[model samples]
Structure formats: structure tokens, C-alpha cells
Target: MRIYLDNAATTPLNREVFLAMEPYFFENFGNPSSAHHHGRGAKVAIAQARGIIADLLNASPDNIVFTSGGSEADNTAILSGIRSNGIKLAITSAFEHHAVLHTLQALEKNGEIRIVYLQHDAQGNLSLPHLEKLLSTNERAFVSVMHGNNEIGNLNDIEAIAQVCKRYQAVFHSDTVQSMGQYRYDTRRLNADFLVGSAHKFHGPKGIGFLYRNAGQALYPLIYGGAQEQKQRAGTENVTGIVGLAKALEISYRNQEVTRQHLLRLKERLIFKLRDRIADVDFNGNSANTGQSLNSVLSVSVPDPNTGISLISYLDQHQISVSGGSACNSHSGAASHVLSALDTPFGRATVRFSFSRYNTAEEIDYAVEKLAKCYAKPGVSAYAEGLLL
Candidate 1:
């Protein structure tokens, strides 16, 4: 049986989500921007989906803007939030998803703002003191931080971070793509100016995501043409995808507690089994603790960099699907900047095993068992160890 544990990358579409979206594919197909009976049906579906999501996050429907995916949502939140406020500086953590990091970098490259990277601890925590220093030392600042590190699964204290931003009077944005389904978020309680999410991250269809822009934040559009998303995102809305997204969010939240417990146990099982089966095994960030990190993700650093094929490739050969890093950087031909920035041993191989609600304890065992065989191969572990010294 194939064991797929890369939910951090993307999840399989829930059957319920598909059924919710099925009618929009052909029967009620219409462009939301058009003004006709067909178009009215599509528009209502999109509005209902947006309202459902807004209710879940405790935000007004007008505050949520649909985007192509997390990248666009993040870019919209960061760039627009920065420029809208005439911000001169941007601050972010070293472990943010490229969607946030790269957007900050591009803005810096264009001389729009100076970028400050907050200090990150070995446990994958961002230093609030460093953030305070940067904020106090700078002008109006735009800060972007992710709720969870995609690679290491470190959960940042967003509420604390939001408080700091409020104290500094800085604009704050968080990429909640990884944590939205796993944790509960109340925009009223958390005062972040912007929050972003991708539907695919939570078993919804891909190519659909949302950016929650705080109700009084006057932000401009990234895509401008016709009036859609309140003229904030100018493109025909993905009606089917939006409906799927709402249904997926509903299903995830319905079982969030039960799924959380199940995934946590699976993570702990892998942690102990890896230590028992492999020498010098390590878990990145605070992912070893379910309470501290994302319960679904465990960044496993092993001693083997098997020749001929990668550790991920070896696991794939054994019908276990995993990833070396974020799927976004899968084809970037670059090492994980998150791990590298943390001064990780250059020789070790890191595999991100992100679980879903569907993953079972038996599947976890099978992955670890297959991993043992991969390490048993000639020159795998020894090679990784020899280079460590």
C-alpha cells in the first residue's frame, strides 16, 4: 500500500468538496462578472462561499479577497499592505514561505522598502526582541510572518507577534496557508492586518485562495481590469473552486479536534520509531513536539544522502511519497533555505513528512519501515555521517 504523507505540500481533494463543486462545472457554469441568470447563479455561489469562509474566520465578507492561490494572496497582502500605508520598511522571519519572503525581496530589490529578517532560534522560534529592535529602529514597517513553517512545522506565536506589531504601529500580515485548517483563527482576537490561505492546503481545490484584509485597510489591487472581489482582485472568480473551498473548510473544521489528536499521535510515533531505527536522526524546528510545532508536519533529518537517487526518490521507490522540502521549491534546484539558514549539517538529508486527516498509524509504520531499508543500503548512512564530521 502506498503511504502519502505530504499534506503540507497539498492535500487530496475531499469527496464532499468535489460533490459540492460538481454542479458548477457544467450545470450552473457562468462567469461571476457577467449579469445574467447563469451569471447570477455563479455569483451567488461565490458570495455564499466567501460568506462561509468569512464566518469561519470571524471576518466580514468584504474583508476577504479571492486570489489565485497563497502566493498571490501573500503578495497582495504584503505589497498592497506596504504601499497602501506608505511603509518604508518590511520585516519577516527567515523561515517564511517564499510567497512572503520573495515578495519582500522583490519589494526591496525595487527599493520600495528595506527588509529586516528577524532572528530565528534553533528551535525555529522567531525572536520578538529582534523584531522589537527592528521596529523601533525603523520607520513605518510592514511585517510578514507565517503562522507555521512549511518545512519544519514551527508554529509562531502570531497573537504575540500581532501585539508587537500593534505596539509598534506596524502593518502585519501572516501566511496562514499551512495553519488555517489545523488551528482556529478569530480575526477579532488576532489583530493582524492581513491573513492569507490556500484552499488546496486544506483538501480544497487548487487555484483558489483568500486574503483577509482588515476592514479599514485601504489597499489597492494587484490585478486590475473589471470589478470583482470588490475590484480588489480583478479576475473572473473561480465559482466551482470557491464552493469546494468552503465545503473543504467546513469538513476540516468539523473534525478538527479529532483529526488533531490522530495526527499528533502519528507524529509522535514517527519521532520515537525514527530514533529507535536510525542513528543520529534529527527533527527540525520544534516539530518534535506537537504542541509547539504543526502536529501534521515533522521535518526528519537523516544521516543518509543515498547515491543514484535522493532519499525522497528511494522512498518513492518503496511506494512512500514524501518531499525534501516545500513543493514550491521542489523544482527550484536550490537547497532548502530554511534548513540552510539554520546552519544544518550540509551532508544530511531532510525529508518533510506532513500528515493529513486520512493518514493512519499503520501508514506511519510502513513509511518508517521503508525508510529503514533505504538507510540499510551501502554507503548511505556512513556517507552522511562521514561528512558531518
Candidate 2:
């Protein structure tokens, strides 16, 4: 009875995706770069996958470039866009994941780019006025913002941000890995110059992701090798992974509306149960009034001075899976930057529970009951403190 509620970190691979990739592993294994029939078969699979992904994003197939994963896609967008466009500054929010933050920081330290961190409101909403001020101050720069936050589940107003970027004539990029399969995405409406996503975030295989480079924008290559991905990313393609990605995206898109409705219901149920059962538990993202949060993720903070890691361990022992923060940095033992941005006083107790289509309401109820019991135990608090210290 192990319940998995950490879909934001990575989803369980779908059976359909795994089945689609089986043949490519042995029977049809071929390097897409080679010239024989086996190679042609792999090339055709890659092309079909690219087309499917392009259709999902509402962009032409030519606009998409395959990468190793989301991190590589982020690096290609920020570092390559800055290098190619000669933009010396990058504007991003304080709540960005480390993939974007670390890349920007490294560039800043190398004296190649100036990084400006935008402040957010207490509800995790970006300040449009502050964004305008920064953009106006730096007329030409590269901007990277995520479509939906990985930890707190707050979705940014990409349309408003894009309008500001248009006014300033700056390059805009978004990390769409968390939002892509969960919501409907239209590149034209987003009006972003660069976008990134990973397959593993949406029930696809790992080690594969894509970057959407708007037409007419050129990005410098991160790796140099034989020309592939239109010479933008040069490496041998991961044929099986790419095939699995396409199948996953296709199934996700076909079921998007149904999945969204199911997740929204689960979110409502979880929120209600937590409020009824837990004391002094506060949500860290936008309230229900703002209409800006994603239904797939729900973050809660307990007021007790207990470490989330301890709660995570208790949940694990009870056969429940959840996360304290972004899985990418869970081991670091540092405060979540997203919670800090929201000015949450109980940031140390924050725990994120994200859902997917496979999640059930029974599991949610069990998790809430277990959490309430854990919080009421005085010994649990002491144990949590010991581990933190």
C-alpha cells in the first residue's frame, strides 16, 4: 500500500511508453546518424516523436531541439541565448529552480552576464511593476522564468510577463517541465523566445527533453559534434527514450482535460481534509482567490518547529512517498527559496505533495490521517529536532 504523491519530482513511467520503447532497445536499435535501414528506422521514430511533441506545444517541428534533459535545455537557453544575442544581463525571479539560478550565477561570476533577482508578493505572485522597472532599466537582456513552480505549485502569469518582455524587446525563456503535460500550452500565446521541458516529468522516460527555440532566433551550441538537432545540439540521439517521450506526450495530450479535472478534484479534497484534520497548517502558495496555482501540486507548512525530513521519514515508514522540497535539492538541507519568497514564517516545516493521474483519493486521505498523527506526537518533534541538529 505504498502511495506515491511526489509527481512533481518525477512521475512513474507509463506502461504505454515503456511498451513503445521496447522494440528500439534491441530489435530496431540503430544510431539515427547512420545511413542503413536500421538507421532509417531510428531516424523515422525520432522524426515522428519530434512532430508529436511539436504538435503538443503548438509549434512547428523545426522549432524543437532534443536535449539530454531539462537541465541541458535550461543551460542551452540561458547560456547560448546570452552568448549569441550578446545580452550581458539576465532577469529572473527569486523562486526559480537551481538549474536556472546556478547557470545564471555562474555566468555572473564569470563576468559574462549581470543577474537581477525579481521579488515576489507574499502569495508567490511576481510583481509586474518590478518586472517592468527592471526591464526598462536594462533594455536588452535574457529573461528566464518558469511557467509553473516546482515546489509551491504556483503558475506564473507568462502572458503578462511576455507582454513586458515584448515592450522591452528582450529574449524570454521559460522552464515548462512542470507545467507541460499538466496544462494546455500554446507557444503563440506565451510568446516566449525559448522554452524547455523534460519527458520524465510527464510519465515519459528519463534522459530526454526538448527546447523550443522561436523561429528566427539563433542559439549558440553547447556541445560541438556531428550535426544533429539542426546543429543546435550535436550528439547521438537517444532513440528509445525519444520514442517513449512521444508516446507519453501523445497519451497525456489525449487525456489532458480528463486528467486536469481529476487532479483539481484531488487538490480540493486534500486541502479540505488537511484543514479539517491538521492544526495550524498553512498553505504557502496563492490562496484559492487568486486563481494562479496549479492543481497538480499542494504545499503545506506545519507550525511546529519540526524538520520536514523527519516527517518524510515517518511517511516513508508508513509506506507513503512525499517530498520536502524540489527533489533536485532535497539532500542539501537548505531552506526552500520558494517558501522564503512567499515570506512563510514556518518554512522549515513545509512539505510538498504533488499528484498525477494515477493518484487516488483514498491515498490522499490516508496520508492526511498519518500526517495528523505524526504532528500530534510530542516525541516526533523531539526526534525531528535531533535529526536536524
The number of the candidate with the highest lDDT is 1
Error of 1 at 183 (Å): 0.9
| lDDT at 163, model 1 | 96
| TM-scores for all predictions | 0.95, 0.94
Instruction: Give per-residue CA lDDT, model 1, range 37-63, as digits (tens).
Output: 999999999999999999999999998
Candidate 2 residue pairs in backbone clash: none
Worst 10 residues of 2 by lDDT: 380-389
Task: List the global CA lDDT of all models.
Answer: 0.87, 0.85
Clashes of each: 0, 0
- The per-residue C-alpha lDDT of model 2 at residue 85 equals 89
